[model samples]
Target: MAYIFLDESGHLYTQIIGEILEMYTPTTDLDFRVFCDQRHLKGITRAQFKEMLRTRLLPLLPKGAILQIEMIDSTTNANIQIADWITGALAKYLEKQKWGEEYYSILKNNIIGEGKELFKDYWVEAKTNKKLESK
Candidate 1:
């Protein structure tokens, strides 16, 4: 049995299943424009936008899901300027937003940091597999 921890940013979804992981970053502006146009927002607020994302995400997620969504306050930090630049570029190119600093921090601090031991274990396993293949 495998416990898959799923995460998403903008319209792109990432899935990490066992040792294999896949990420899809859409490459067309039309795709995002179509999505935005189809959403048919009647003056939708930011909160509504977030809620819509959560609702769409919920059904695709596994049962008893452990999901976290953090919104970074762009008004308070210099990092947000960098984030805005990234998002603006993405918006121009793909019509989507990238993960902001808060989410990035969560990944760096929580997932990656806590999973260091697991990463080390995988590193060892990978080395062992390579050695076996060479022998």
Candidate 2:
């Protein structure tokens, strides 16, 4: 899992969704299902949220690719709950909170990349991806 510093960003949903989606190759006839934890969105409607995802995702797909995105309450999903717990632990660890290292160490092996700042290399990388997609 990649650790992204998302603090006070209104576009947190996109970041989480995009990061997960970018992990896979967009192949023909691909059916990608992404489950996101529902949160109170400030400005956009739920429909707009889904559409925004499709806007970003569809460009990566070829002729025929199916993308399924669902926003569900975290309470109803055990997998989401585990993810939330892990996120919380990692956030605390990154923030250097009490017992952060101890908790982070438990799941250290699962972490892929650490210290990824959202504002720094993300946009550059996204542009690079777009360029790669065109070629």
Candidate 3:
């Protein structure tokens, strides 16, 4: 399973890169130090970030791959604003991509009501299956 933690800075592009990097290289296992550089959150609009994620990152995933997205609302930051914008934009994008109903159903069935332990189990199971299938 691929885990993506998203946040926004001055420009959406930089925000995407920063967060993705942090996820791949964390400071400590429990450090929770990942953050977008706020200085980059100046002039860029959220719409641009959403479009970039859809056009760029979305295509990189294999067809039929499932994506689980989560946002960290840290300390009343502007990143929250960007996150909200991105969330809405993503919903719209998913609909346009014709993946709305199916994706939401999966999240509701597996992750939400069932609790995070189940989510983790599902993620691990999915990842293991993907790895085996690719072998």
Each candidate: what lDDT? 0.40, 0.75, 0.47
Task: Give one digit per residue, the lDDT tens place, for model 3 in 6-63.
Answer: 4423454544453464343322233222343233234555445444444444444556
Assess the local accuracy of residue 18 in candidate 3 as a C-alpha lDDT between 0 and 100.
Answer: 39
Taking all chains together, each candidate's TM-score versus the true structure is 0.30, 0.70, 0.28
Candidate 1 residue-wise lDDT at 113 = 25
Off by over 4 Å in 1: 1-42, 88-135
Question: Could you tell me the lDDT of residue 22 within candidate 2?
Answer: 65
Regions of candidate 3 where Cα sits further than 4 Å from its true position: 1-9, 12-40, 68-71, 76-135
- Among the numbered candidates, top lDDT falls to 2
Q: Compare candidates 1 and 3 on lDDT and give the better one.
A: 3
| lDDT, model 3 | 0.47
Best by TM-score: 2
